[model samples]
Target: MDNTDTPSSARQSLLDATEALIYAGGINATGMDAIVKASGVARKTIYRHFATKDALVAQALRERDARWMRWFSEETCRAEPGPARLLASFDALSSWFATPGFRGCAFINAAGETGDPADPIRIVAREHKASLRAFLLQLAIEAYIADADALAGAWLILIDGAISVALVTGDLQAARRAQAMARCLLPTFFAPTTKELP
Candidate 1:
């Protein structure tokens, strides 16, 4: 298998075109010819870079996972740390949902089309979601919230649900609604300080 990040213009173009095509259409629908035409890279060049279409798709997804996580962290971290910062996660999703050509999460869409749990697309999607959940877990821990793992897991549900709702219903307020639900659930964590003052 060829490395997609080998810092070649042809490889990068293939990666870029593959991501855009698959994201707009789907993994099953996108073809190497379309990628070649869109990227303006020759078919032989694309094959030289990526051993196969799946390899290109996998690499594109991996790169996108990194990019998406960076954007999510930056967007949510813009707010002050605490419950508000946790809630900012939803705000970040809202912003993403409103973006032009927003067609739901790349990972979710890819995984939906993939049946085999062992497929690279499925593995990439799983890893991406795990990374997202880990980020939420970190946020929960940082806020001194109890049951950080559970809260983070639930938050991941809300985030994914909101994305699905927005995509299916064209409702931009999906994230906000999920955020409201999260707010309702958050109060259980708040309580009077029990630790003795130093």
Candidate 2:
């Protein structure tokens, strides 16, 4: 048997193909036949791995969420620590926006595709957002921002708005604008003094 014929390989191929197609178009636009053709996996093999299309989509999204978070973290970590790192997130986003075939955020697209609140795709989308918020909250805490939770929430709004606006207007500068706003807002939360002055 060929190395690519393994169950794991087949599953991963399906997921990779599905993610690519979904990113290019949308969940509704991509069909099982397309996935089968793109992945080069037999229909029975696809069903063996995923009982349904929704199941396959959910798995693909989960994989995407993990991959995106890893990439974001790596990009953000490249900046100086503390507040600088927080602002660097925007720079990272700007780079992402500039990438070829940039088509808004995958999570946002998935959420908008499904109207059902309890849908698996919607659930994964929400989870992705929550994870991003948590990452921002961690950054806020590291920066010693007062009301870290609120700061994180504000950051989330700015990030989401910037992404949406960039997609609609094709303006990559949205990230820089959002970063400037974040910088202006950061002074409101100063790190607590740990040592008493003489």
Q: Which numbered prediction scores highest in TM-score against the true structure?
A: 2
What would the per-residue lDDT of candidate 2 be over residues 1-198, giving only the tens digit for each residue?
Answer: 122667899889989999999988999999988988899988888888899998999899999999999999899989877788888899999999999989889889989999999999999999999999999999878767768898888889999999999998999899999999988877666646532110
List runs of model 2 lying over 4 Å from the truth.
1-3, 191-198
Candidate whose lDDT is highest:
1
Model 1: lDDT of residue 80 = 84
Model 1, span 1-198: residue lDDT tens = 233445486678778889999999999899777887888787777777778888889999999999999999999999888888999999999999989989999999999999999998899999999999999999988887777888899999999999999999999999999999998888665445623110
Q: How do all models score by TM-score?
A: 0.92, 0.93
Worst 10-residue lDDT window, candidate 1: 189-198
In model 1, residue pairs whose N, Cα or C atoms come closer than 3 Å (at least 3 residues apart or on different chains), thus clashing, are none
Lowest summed lDDT across 10 adjacent residues in model 2 is found at: 189-198
Off by over 4 Å in 1: 1-7, 190-198
Model 2 / residue 15 / CA error / Å: 0.4
